[model samples]
Target: MAETFAPVQPDNRMAAMSIVAATCFIALSTLFAKMLTTDALGPALSPFQVSHGRFVFALLFFVVGVAVIRPRLTRPHWGLHLARTGCGWGGVTLMFAAVAFIPMADATALSFTSPVFTLIFAVVLLGETVGWVRWAAVAVALTGAAVLLRPTPESFQPAALLALGAAVAMGTENIWIKKLTRREGRLQILLVNNLVGVVIASAALLAVGWQSPTSAQWGALAGVGLSMATAQSFYINGMARADASFVAPFIYGTLVFAALYDAVIFGAVPDWVSWLGAAIIVAGALLLAWREGRKRPTRLHPVAGVVK
Candidate 1:
């Protein structure tokens, strides 16, 4: 979706910081999700309801943003927005579901395989090229993911599969996002995506029989929505300034935060396999980031200040 070299602006610091900030919020979102989907808080809420709450509350935040900033709404890119929202809603719902059954670290690490899928989508859908180095990087990351999957029946966990599916869905969402960034303003992009997402999430919640959340669970759901909205903003802003692959490695920061929350709040210590798998995944992803950085230029376009 992007040029082989991203059309990066000179505000590299802002882009990098935005990605880092996104990672933090992303971890917070999943932390809340783990609480809501499990007894860590109260009666577990369904992933559909959790995801629905995510979209609704996030849309509410943007509504306030719109009322104040009053950004001149861009013409709708309906088809793209719909496709992106479908994948985003599904990916997050699957992830919220997975965190209910697996350790937050395990789910987060497996999701790290997303960039490999993002690279493949770029190559196939956009007709971009991927050299052997990138292919090798893909292999390394997949191996790490497989370590987490442990598909054999004895050690197998179906919940891990949900996280893997989320990775694919999220990776597809990444391509759509990168395409959107090159053409749209950041705030409007988020506003429209959430607008589309709330519609989808609401329909799914209805199908699943939505239930009222406990007061504590309501707070958790709000955390999912607000944190995800904030994370989405930073992620979108970062993508506007960097390639999707370039943004991928920095997201590994999320695993650290997720692991910390799990340990501190849930007291669910990670086993050796989780640590090992995550290390391998990060190694491969960071290598891809290093190569992508060396290849991308300092300034290929004037992408400074706000995307608008």
Candidate 2:
């Protein structure tokens, strides 16, 4: 007799809930990042320092994970790992910097535009076709981004551009992670990712001035690392268990969490513009995602982390 194994079935409900949990963690990570950039916590730390803490602490978490599980190792693809970690670090750092200057709600909404950028990257990097439907979707998302930017002198914030840059970097990371997941196990991918990330972040941190983080600052930095690590775990699980599009819409909940966290912690309430711009971005992203899902049911996957 041959031994048989149980095949896992898709549980849409669990996957959706997992995405919600991931969003909550991602928003919490942003809140912790914002707290670090404020003097109220202690000495305000630069985004480079914040990013450094994220990679270092997140690496520790993974190291503990590896020691406990002792995952099977494979030949490392150092170049691909470097590219993915480089983009991830850049995206994380820019978003951290942006949140320091603008409301988290606004920053989260702007970062949501990354899916559109991913579509553009797919076209160039993978030779994927973009018909009129995708182009229109991209245009709608960009328009929403413009609304979020508030281009007028009284409302314009240069820091918002940093958020947009983060989106671009994340979109590019999406391309690289897609390639990586094809050949690597999740544990291997994540382990190599953070290992490379710490190296890159350390180099950047050294170039910038470093100060000993205060006790409160250390707490905030630890929060950023742990929350983000938790988020990446849940996000990967969710994507593994469901079709990407089926769970992708649930990610918009990050904006809601960000706004709620902002209100409760920072007392920064999102006005009509924030709501409208966020609504528009979500609409366009959903449209684009669903359209692609119909065309290619099993191929789509979200970026490695929730919103990072």
Candidate 3:
């Protein structure tokens, strides 16, 4: 029988710190990605080329890690893996495109809509029951997204749409991830995701002529890969060490970090309306996480039968 880990006592402080670190790394990754497509590199690289470089470097990192770790590899449910990979690749592509054209803060804020979409998918696809409160939370989140988007002909930007599309793809990918986690190791999932991303992005690059990146651009791409992988590691560690509810609230810190990066690096500050919308979205997500935490059965210690 596969050995199960003992239920870990929640470490709120460590979890909080880990999440903050994860958020910062994520912000750094976004900053690096945006740098690749901006005048900082002289002529901006194409979004596809940037995406290709990111996945290529990320895959190289994962391959080296895998060689060192030598994790057990299992082949189960390849179809679902492919589906999840497709959704994730699509999300990453759209997100990079959004970052190229939109403010980092806006793109990050809109990405939070993934959890709301995940809730909807859970209800419809997973046959999970969502009560009135959760529904209300979803509605509030959507309203916030609309407030940020502001959909006027003069105000609307297509990049905003791309961000939302990324959210939806990520949400669907999240559902698949939930299913896969029941049967796969973390490294296995990540390996497949990066591998597929590299393949898809490489194919896309072929269609659009690969642009040779300068030395500085190469450094930025390396940063993107390293930061992204480290961010995922930090986030997973944080969530594993603490309750999901506790860790989830801290995940919203990504928006704050992204906003700060936007201001400091890009000199673009979001307007008051955008800030308000971000607040609303964070509020709704917190509520949803709280409710979901309550719904989950508390794990009990084997000897004492006391909740851990």
Candidate 4:
């Protein structure tokens, strides 16, 4: 008798695990950012500077890493690279700007809207079909977003609009990245994105007159970039190994970390209403991920002739 093995499927568990690690790093990055930028330096730098510095450092780091790992670059996918770069840079700029204004957790929750946008983009730009179930999932996510924003008499923060814009750009970028992945390597994707971000952000800062940073501030900036870079690597590695449904909700758990960091570091905390909104957002996102899992058949495809 032949031995039988269980069927394997490409679940997003690894991606979900990546989210958890990424969230932690991101929370730390936010903490360092709030401290280094405001207290250490009397003058606050614009979002352009922070974003530019982060990308420049991140790109340099990635380049060095790639040189060591020496991952083979596939044929250039210029169209996909351009699309991803354009949308990603736009989103990054907007999100960073929002961070300069709002509490980190609130901005993060707003950024969660990116997936909702991605779902719509997949259907419209990628020509992918989403059944009514997924659309309903999307609707729930939107409802959660509304709860967070709450345009009624009290709960609105205009700064959140920047985060909402970031979501749109991020959503568009996700579609472009999905397209690029067909022909490009993951590091290559990061390379193009960082390059674009550095170029665009640096150019924007030139118009406003860039601020000189203290050595400590520079160190914090570098720290932010490095933490984010490591987070990305961890996410990629983790998601490759775990089931997505098992991992995604924990990624949202980053908000808890963010809130705690904000309170301890800046004495900031979201009101009860905001907390409720965050819960709704998480619930909706969970539904979307679950629905996504149901729609796709669970079977892992071998990549580059290697079983993951």
Best by lDDT: 1
lDDT tens digits, residue span 1-308, model 2: 12222222345556657777998998899889878977879878988898889878888898899889986666777788888888887887788788788876578567767766776777777565667766676666566655654544422378889988998998788667655655555666777887887888889888987989998899889989989888877766665555443443456557667777878887988789867867775686567556655653332324433311
The regions of model 3 sitting more than 4 angstroms off are: 1-24, 92-112, 141-166, 234-254, 269-271, 288-297, 300-308
Q: Is candidate 2 or candidate 4 better by lDDT?
A: 2
In model 4, where do residues sit more than 4 Å from their true spots? 1-9, 40-42, 92-112, 129-165, 234-256, 269-271, 288-297, 300-308
Strongest candidate by TM-score: 1
- Cα miss at 91, model 4 (Å)? 2.8
What C-alpha lDDT do the candidate models reach, one value each? 0.75, 0.71, 0.71, 0.65
Tens digit per residue, CA lDDT, model 3, 157-249: 867888889989977875676556545666666777778888888899999997788999999989888888788667655654554333434
Candidate 1's C-alpha runs over 4 A off are 1-17, 92-112, 136-166, 271-273, 293-298, 303-308
Deviation (Å) of 273 in candidate 3: 3.5
Task: Report the lDDT tens digits of candidate 4 across residue range 1-308.
Answer: 12222222345644555666787887787666665557555466666677777778888889998889876666666777777778877787787788788876577667767766777777777676666655665566456555654544321388879988998887777666656544456676677667777887788889877888878778888987887777666654444444322333344445556766777777876778657756765675577567656654455555442333
List the candidate 2 regions with Cα displacement exceeding 4 Å.
1-21, 92-112, 127-166, 237-253, 281-308
TM-score of each: 0.78, 0.72, 0.73, 0.73
In lDDT terms, how accurate is model 2? 0.71
Model 3, clash count? 0
- Write the number of the candidate with greater lDDT, choosing between 1 and 4: 1
